[model samples]
Target: MDRAVLRDDMVDSLEHEAKGWINTESVSLAMRSVPRHEFVPDEQRAYADCSFEQFGTRVLAPSTAARLVEALDPTPDDSVLIVGVGVGYTAAVVAEIVGDQNVQAIDITRRLVWEARNNLARAGYNGVLVDRHDGSDGLPAYAPYDRILLEAAAIEPPQTLLRQLGASGHLVMPLGASTQRLVSVSKDGTTVDEFGRVAFSPMLVDGEQVDTVERNRTVREDREFAARESEGRHGWEQHWIDWTHGQKH
Candidate 1:
């Protein structure tokens, strides 16, 4: 079967009433146009509505990507930023809608950044920029994007990312710590519309990428333990000398 036919089939499933993931025509067309097989390791499974793991990051399921892009609702030629580029599949879809030159993406993991770059290029979206940067900080050099999509979960919208949104922009993310919900926030950060529950890995900070030798939390936790021990009393200090108390009695 042709890859294009496979892609059409994938989009059809997403638009079908059973899934209803692709609600808008733009998303439907974009998904169909972009060749998902070029972005995933397994061309055989590329159109499957299932997720894949690559370079320690997740290649979101087609349905999940459709939901995100639909929520993002990017317009043609809109400047868009995609945090957590993953395998660059979502970025390619967005590029189809917004033009490759109008899309910029970033990832905290260096290897994944390279992976996304290669994948995007292979998928004929070389104009889209994929950089290795902390997702929280965003790509500030190209700040004030018309639309922002965060693929990772964050406890709250990153303030820096919010600051980078254009005056009339929308930032969509899986918001929450333990229980995540897909949400879209207005540029002012006041008008938030939730689109039900989702589960995504928490956003990674510096030194927390899968390739890092030591996680940031481990070093921070060790320092915290040391500080607590220093502030605490030792064995002899814990046992009060009762000389003064006994004399008073």
Candidate 2:
């Protein structure tokens, strides 16, 4: 089957009543234009509505990507920053909406950075700049982006990323720890509109990349200390002592 036809079918399913992920025309057109197969390892399953794991990162399914892009609501010429550029599929889709050169992406893992670069090039979106950097820090050189999208989950929006957004810009990400919700936040970090629930991997710090050696001893020690503290707690200390739970002893 033709790749273009497959893309059409994929978008068709996304826009259908059962799964209305692709709402706007921009997102619909962009998803159709970008060749998803070029960014995925398994070309045969590229258009399937399923996620893939590559280089220790998750390649979001088409419906998930469509949801993110639709929430982003990017326009042509908008400067967009994409954190956690897994397989470059989402970046490619964004590149179609915004000009290719207007898209900047970063990943914590160096290998995934290389893979994303190569994948974008193969997909004819070489204009998208991809670099290996901590997603929390963002691509500062190109600060003040019109829109920012973080593909990973974060307990709270990174302050640095919020500072990098243009005065009127907004950021979309999966926010929280145990449970996550897809949200769009204003530049001032005040207004947050939740799209729905979503699940994504936690954002990686500087030394946490899968390819990097485990050399951050401080983090390891902190975890061990917390474990020891938990073990030491007993009886009332086992859980938070609620004065309201008991009247006087």
Top-lDDT candidate index:
2
True-vs-predicted CA distance for residue 117, candidate 2, Å: 0.4
lDDT of 1 at 229: 81
Question: For residues 93-167, could you state the per-residue lDDT of candidate 2 as single tens digits?
Answer: 999999999999998888889999999999999899999998778999998899999998876778899999999
- What's the CA error at residue 161 for candidate 1, in Å? 0.5
Model 2 segments more than 4 A misplaced:
211-249
lDDT: worst 10-residue window of model 1: 212-221
Q: Residue-wise lDDT of candidate 1 within 109-180, one digit each (tens)?
A: 888889889989998999999999988889999988999999987766778899999999999999876688
Top-TM-score candidate index: 2
Q: Please give me the total number of clashing residue pairs in predicted model 2.
A: 0
Clashes per candidate (backbone, < 3 Å): 0, 0
Error of 2 at 246 (Å): 15
Tell me the TM-score of model 1.
Answer: 0.85
Off by over 4 Å in 1: 211-249
